[model samples]
Target chain A: MKPAHRKIEAPRVTVDIVIFTIEEAKLKTLLIKRKFDPFKNIWALPGGFVRSKEDIYAAALRELSEESGISGVYLEQLYTFGSPKRDPRGRVITIAYFALASRQKLRIRSASDAKDAGLFSVDDLPRLAFDHKEILEKALERLGNKIQYTNVLWSLLPEYFTLGDIQRVYEIIWGKKADKRNFRKKLLSLGLLKPIGKLRKGLRRRPARLYQFKTKKYVELKRFF
Target chain B: MKPAHRKIEAPRVTVDIVIFTIEEAKLKTLLIKRKFDPFKNIWALPGGFVRSKEDIYAAALRELSEESGISGVYLEQLYTFGSPKRDPRGRVITIAYFALASRQKLRIRSASDAKDAGLFSVDDLPRLAFDHKEILEKALERLGNKIQYTNVLWSLLPEYFTLGDIQRVYEIIWGKKADKRNFRKKLLSLGLLKPIGKLRKGLRRRPARLYQFKTKKYVELKRFF
Candidate 1:
């Protein structure tokens, strides 16, 4: 039975991060293979226990760095999962966060309680440890809804890319294709991107003009799809 | 010194809620005078610690109901504030939540851990206890940003209202007046509101048509200010 509402209880707190990026036109997340027991050898979000004297966000960044050797990504607090039975060890709560990393910043060096780490396409993920699968679903929903009116998707793209490149990123996350003509016209009208006056010349067909966001920082759009 | 990263520690967890409603065309939040020590005689957001076995959301709703006697309002997980020094009693971390209660459904019968309860305008609030002031500020920012692109503002207004009535709610929350012409035109273009086909008849001047949102539930707008 649960304690009375007035009775004070301290549940263990931890931080978990769902680091996301775009690769091969599919959404991918960084997962670390756990090295120790409870769920040994199972892949889970890169995270660890929040230290006694640390902020939750700082804990997320530190764990991401320690477990996967990835840092400085644009991370935001996604949600807090505090189901008392979530952890087998005891009553534990986790502060879940989501991060966006561009492909250029992708690197990994699994260590410190992590047996191995790699990016797995969100479409085909291994059985995750704890309630991480639920956490990933929430992160994906947030990412999908946000990219409609926020510039977060640009964080997964190169600094300069063709219009088609950006549209493909959106489609990959949405898991469906957008009408090419309407998407290009509507996306261009948002004025979120600016032409670089330079074109890509390596393509077999005509060189395509490159464009980049006016500001790389993720911000909400006044109007969007 | 603090224990190593692998050392498991249980930190006290609490749930705090910022209950917001619009009154007199000003954004207001429910505050309760603390009934017990640590912050007694001081007003704080309605909240309490989570029980040994309960979900965080259930804790939030239970706390709100126990103190304010308001329930069935729209509540969402805002953010978690877990700074080690936040609580004076011990190392307590709070999972904060925010709620939207319509003025009609709001009724206060302060009980449980509340000494008194009242509505205070967000623009001019009394000094709050604990880290509640900071939590309220975060809630207000989330509310401000959300209303721009979501139909949440309707939750604070009457079911049948004039176009001007809805615009005033926006202006009040935004803390500034919007261009009437553009606000009305742009708002109508969204096709969110439907005319009730009846006019309000209590005024001395011409009776204006009453309008209600097509749906009362909060929904995201495809395009908004």
Candidate 2:
């Protein structure tokens, strides 16, 4: 017979989100200034501890809303960071999530445990708290790779966008300039975008033809792309 | 000033491993028969609770060793499962991991909390305990997708293997027959395999040349592949 199993202590679990969006033709992420000690007042990913009765996903959504004042946007679990020394407050393991959304949709404000919150370009991030710098780098890498094979880049665009608008989102996330004609050709070949039969308004230059992402086509072609 | 945060209860965390190996040209996974309630006698992935002082990765390795009697193999964190109703023992969340190794190296036995342990082909798995079925399916899908872009499948092969042996591993994981010439052409064109300049000694037919995976080349060519 097996000996009685000993009760094990659980690690304190927290959820951190690296929320990405495209603003001013550049990729930006939301960050919150910590209000408490152990890197207090430094910028970090918006997150908090998981509540006893909440599921992990629910906890992530709650924390995202409380810290950034944004909700209902879908997030993907990027990774779990649990280095023994990652947290000074003793054995806290964090489940990291990444979300992509349109910059105009989020009305972020400092709330709950945060002192301040704002969007910063990925290229011009401040010195982050905890292992948040590492987390953001990993999230960016995931985003770059995901945009190539998935329709996830649509999350960073508005309801109706021109082909140039979509290409700029890709270029910003990928950190490189893409050939405009080739970029449109590749995306159009996938058949995941539908022309809106209208032009994007308010552009200084001639209005470009607008397109909307076809959710059904994107779902069908997800596996192949 | 922000209000002081209330102390929150942490969810009970565990680590579950989907140990995979290629045996008899079939992809097999190691499953342990649960000896305790919740899912008594049900075959499940080898796993256990995380200790207070152990890192998450270390906890995964320790649990894998205790239940399967196998150690030292590298494991990748697959995903975390934390549905509120996943475990009847109240708010238990599990970090799932997947490992690839050769069958001969593993000396698996039913140890620790497991009643019995054995290998089951991926296609013929028994109804697993605690959302393990979903975990295994995800791992298999990851393996299929990874084989195309990463050199991860090399973990399933012996150090010195023939081209045919490598092809068999791919066919087993992908569940499809690949054209021998095209497969060899693609893999060889990558320059990630080095020929040993020796032929199989025991074969009755013409001996095939042996080759070893070139880790350095795989690393350099990782981004493109």
Candidate 3:
């Protein structure tokens, strides 16, 4: 009876991180091939079981680090997937996190936990295991909608960036050409960007000005969305 | 050896509905007291196991009917909770759905599945089992934010309601007073409301006019948010 009770007490939970970075003018996500059973060798989001002491966010960051050797990125809870059949192995509940980093900044040294790891464009991802395709769709929608109302785009930006660079990221993620004038006008109206007295030098076009984040505005307008 | 290779399977999934209906100018949620062990006698969201044949949304709707006497309402997925220790007895993955209905339309009758069922104001909710409180918060935030952008407010309105009535619901959910003039202007800009040839009779002074929803706008502008 005690053994049966113990068996009933255990619950399986995992964390999956949807790491988005802009590469080759496209929004890409880090995915890995599972080497074990339950969709073995199939590509899936970098994820793993949560440890006893950590919270949901910590587990996602840990799994992300373990799979791709990346850490300390801005990670937010995307959503949780608890459909009983979402996991082919047992009753596994998976919490998904969305991590944003610049494409140029991401440095992955190893795909240790996964059979292999690589970045795939969000628009044309390979077949993923489980209900990950649905999960990815939801994450993309959430991220796109969030950037419209919240300053969530900042995490995907560098400390100093050109307006065109920001516009390109939005175009890549939103899947449309944003009215450049209106996009710049609306974001600047929010008073969250500050010019840093620097300009880009090597482009064939006009030299673009660089700006840094006004961190105070983000905290002050935390509930803007 | 062949028998040892048990095919991996997803655990039995369940969807819980947190239906909110406004009554007497208060935000309330439908709660049911559990009659079985593992948080027995605890107040919880009305829910049940998802059947093998039905989808998650269907399961949530069915559970809403079983636990409470309410049916055929506006429901949307809020979030899913799958922490390993969220359930004390076993690994039961629950997908949460938030349902909206006019408070006056809610009819709660005693049911066999739940020990008790009733609408409780969000501010004064009793001790609930599982991580339902967290789910409740997420649902509330989703509703609040959704109303600001979408015409989802129609779900809480009667066939015809005054601008003030709808605005009050907004204030109650957002916990802030919106400038009445600004509020009305924004709603009017949405062009989703139609002036019906009717007047409200309960006013002490001049009677207020009633407005009906423009159904076509609901579809044409479904992606407004």
Ranking by TM-score: 2, 1, 3
* Candidate 2 displacement at residue B116 in angstroms: 1.0
RMSD of each: 4.7, 3.5, 4.7
Candidate 3: where are CA atoms >4 Å away? Answer: A1-14, A34-42, A48-56, A80-94, A109-113, A175-211, A214-225, B1-14, B36-42, B48-54, B83-93, B111-114, B176-189, B200-208, B216-225
**DockQ values of all predictions:** 0.39, 0.49, 0.20
**Model 2 agreement with the true structure over B1-225: per-residue lDDT tens digits:** 123234776677888998889998789999999998879999999888887778889988887777666665657899988887788767778899988777766778887778899999998989899899999998988877677777877777778999999989988887889899998988899888899899987878889999997672224234322
A1-225 in candidate 2: lDDT tens per residue? 122334776577889999998888888999999998878999999998887778888888887777666765658898898886788777788999988778776879887778889999989999999999999999988887787567877878888888988877777776778887777777899888899899766868888898997782234234322
Give the fraction of reference interface contacts each candidate recovers. 0.68, 0.65, 0.08
Q: Which ten residues in a row have the lowest lDDT in candidate 1 chain A?
A: A1-10
Q: Evaluate all candidate structures by whole-model CA lDDT and list the values in order.
A: 0.85, 0.81, 0.75
Consecutive 10-residue window with the lowest summed lDDT within model 3 chain A: A1-10
Quality of model 2 by C-alpha lDDT: 0.81
Q: Please give, for residues B52-136, the per-residue lDDT of candidate 3 as tens digits.
A: 4455666777877776666656887777765646776544567788888886667786567568878899989999989999989
C-alpha-based local distance difference test score of model 3? 0.75
Question: How does chain A of every candidate compare to the true chain A by TM-score?
Answer: 0.91, 0.91, 0.88
Q: Better model by TM-score, 2 or 3?
A: 2
Off by over 4 Å in 2: A1-6, A216-225, B1-6, B69-72, B216-225
iRMS of candidate 1, Å: 8.0
